[model samples]
Target chain A: MSLIDSISRPRAVRLPRIDGLIQWIVPLAIIAIWQLASVTGFVPTRVLPAPSDVVLSGWKLLLSGELVRNIWVSFWRASIGFLIGGSIGFAFGLANGLSQLSAKLTDTTLQMVRNVPHLALIPLVILWFGIDESAKLFLVALGVFFPIYLNTLHGIRTVDPQLIEMGRIYGMTDGELFRRVIFPGALPSIFVGIRFALGIMWLTLIVAETIAASSGLGYMAMQAREFMLIDVVVLSILIYALLGKLADSASRVLERLTLSWHPAFQKR
Target chain B: MQTALRTALPETELASQANFAPHARVVREERLAQTSGLPLTIRGLRKSFGDNEVLRGIDLHIPAGQFVAIVGKSGCGKSTLLRLIAGLDKIDAGSISFGQDVKPEDIRVMFQEPRLLPWARVLANVEVGLGRDRASQDADARAERALTEVGLADKRHQWPSVLSGGQKQRVALARALVSRPRVLALDEPLGALDALTRISMQRLLERVWRDQGFTAILVTHDVAEAVALADRVLVIEEGRIAHDVVVHAGRPRARGSVELAGLESSILSHLLSADDRT
Candidate 1:
């Protein structure tokens, strides 16, 4: 046999494959233990509901349309906030990246401002815009801006200078240099920024809704807590987790499509 | 061999003989007779980085379509000279003049690394050589033609990262030649390849230079490579031209031939003596 075959063939047999339904075994065991604890009165239901209780409450909310409506409201807020914040971040990042004068003028201030936590601005935002949609939108927008901006700037700065020099030597105009070399070279990092901003978008929405909003997943959970509906609260938390996972999966798909040329994305 | 040549010839005659071959003189004159490409004229060129002078005042003339190789030790400013000719860096003093046929856009430099855009496929990366005029009708056809010349037409759709080191350098060669540049400056373009690949690449480069008829200036530390491809091999020591040895061997020159090995040894001795003086 060839050396490569000799080296690789037995390695597959030594490591057991984790695939198919076997991957779900641990999650199922966790649910089974939780159910047993609830049924045996090892845990109080009022403080923490059983898996079945959470599912039943979720079904009830689904039938009532309250869960869907709240989810829609939360989704709308996150989308609008992200669109506004992400665009500004991208524009500022591009401007600073391309010109030293702009970077010198704006970078220090932006960095100083970025260090202030967006959540800490909750009281100030309420005072300025009141407990309205504007306040919530502003909070979410502020929260999502820094990651995208910082990452975009970092990406532009870290592009290989050799490539840029090659572009210039090949007779590329300034605009063409930016379009073909700078932008694509910075794209992978920009995508990282976008993914990080998406997570922050959800977190900021939760905080905004929990503090003052009338209709979102966070507000639904708070309302359930007031009524001592532990199962409904658990269901809301689960919905948030599901939404976060969906957003993350969508971003990964986009990354795969855009960065197919990257070696990291190539199939073995 | 040196003593035999010295004893058989006078000092002034030996100095002139070492500069270039009679056959190279014929080729240089024939190339100068053609009016298609530009000849390079450099005089009193100087460059410095902080306090260290990279290139002292240097002067050279290159006829159009002549393949010239510069051999130097590390940090001898051979690449600095190539960069100045390619207009990638400014000279501290003196002037470089190209013939009227040559425009700023007609010069291209191929770096040692392929420097291909990782996000682009092979064909698109070659297409980048067309610059901003990519929307022209014949740009795609020309890019394909250049790739085909480099023997990489079939790999047009592959990513650069998927290419081996030699293949990537071939792609880089295709990109450099895609624009049909009048002056092609190569900064140790094949330095990163293995021995076998380097030989193949040298052949490819010589073939391309012959086919394209551009003024080729290559910077390398390999003395054998300098003798193999270049019509004139310039040895740079202490940021100046120390020796100019012209290869008289004809095209499709034999590798490791007795004559070529003799020239290589002579150049090696000159380089070592120069190092000792420094």
Candidate 2:
């Protein structure tokens, strides 16, 4: 049959559990081996804590609610910065993508600005906004802005011309054309931008907090490092990893919700 | 509100008051036993993309409400001609003069790709053809009627991704017809479908055109489709009309009928003859 004739063809594979287990087996085995080595005293405890030791530290932190408090601070700051910077970037990116005059005027300036490291603005941000919440937020926002802007612009520009023409022919106004044809068409790329920006926001927050901060997971880690409380340092790192994973998983859920109707996500 | 604006509705509305009632001002014409509703006149319409000339000194007239198919090899400017008529492409010179009071919104087009918004349900895709304001105000009601017209009322909530190629095209057709455009232009809308699907879509298109009485201009390279769906087929050669054939076969045409096949063969022969001359 031709490819077109196979539109309704039945899927052949059915080993969904096998596919799931295939990914988990190696990671679980590695963790088990590490725990076994620690128990056997193959390595010194000072160098690497057993998984059980880390779990104990985690439990203590959790009981005191210190872990949650620190994490909450980091999460809130990242979210606020992401929302502000991302919105601004999204608007500018869309303008650049849609109009030739805007693209011509802004493309060069955007590229030049994007090349400058956002982290370098730390001292200046601190000087301008002080070593307060605003300074840390400004740093995080600057770090996130470029990825969202660049990806959103790319997404908008790549929307199919044929679809835009289809909208015009159907008596769609400019606003309707953008909403119905352009926005949904650019969604997959826009999600990519959101994901990238979220990752950067976390990274920037860590650096910004490590430099100067009274509360947050990054501040705790920096304080722990000074006293050589390696367990606390490891504990803080673990917390950061868990928090990042949670944020990423939430974003993935958002992506699936928005893009379930996309062709790429449809079941064969 | 003014008293006239708040006046009570009439008990029995006349046909003239209904939205679908054909306008009386339209002067219908006949060519080769087929009805032609209006004339699209273009005088010296010229366009060029930088150094490359796409349409050079083009002048043509298409009778209104007639099913006219434009056929040409790729880059022969057949699609360009359709775009210009639909007002999608701007002309560098001259002007496209429509029949009196011809509004820009009265033209609709169906493209080769289904081009349905992935986020939109099948019904919403159909409703996209309704102007943005209308689609926004009464989206659910308008989408329902359009989906019902396309025999897909049950699939109103179904995503476009789940649709088969033929069903997607059906949604696209529903979108084109929902707004009741006076002129419908199709650019190989059925070309991407399987042969069987294309045949069925051709019949569906013909039925809609006859029932709705909308003028259609189809741009295609398939001789069979040109003969089957069009009232008059214009074979464009070198950016100009070379042969214009009036297909005499009546509407509700069977896909593999001997009469339909004969007309298809005649067009094929004409295309070959033109090819030889070129």
Native contact fraction of candidate 2?
A: 0.88
The TM-scores, one per candidate, come to: 0.91, 0.82
Off by over 4 Å in 1: A1-25, B1-36
User: What is the DockQ for all candidates, taken in turn?
Assistant: 0.66, 0.49
Q: Categorize the docking of model 2.
A: medium
Given candidate 1, what's the lDDT at residue B46? 95
- What TM value does chain A in model 1 reach? 0.90
Clashing pairs in 1: none
- Per-prediction TM-score of chain B? 0.90, 0.81
Model 1, range B135-228, lDDT digits (tens) per residue? 7899889999999999999999999999999999999999888888888999999899999999999999989887778889999989999999
DockQ for model 2? 0.49
TM-score of 1: 0.91
For B1-278, candidate 2 gives per-residue lDDT tens digits of 11211131122212212321221112223432353344566767777778877776655566656777888778878898888888888888878876677765477878888888778788777777777446377777876787787788898889987889999989988887777777888999988999998888888888778766677899998988987788666666666555555565655666668876776676677667767987
Kindly report which residue stretches of model 2 are placed more than 4 angstroms away from their true locations once superposed: A1-29, A63-65, A120-131, A266-268, B1-64, B92-98, B132-142, B254-266
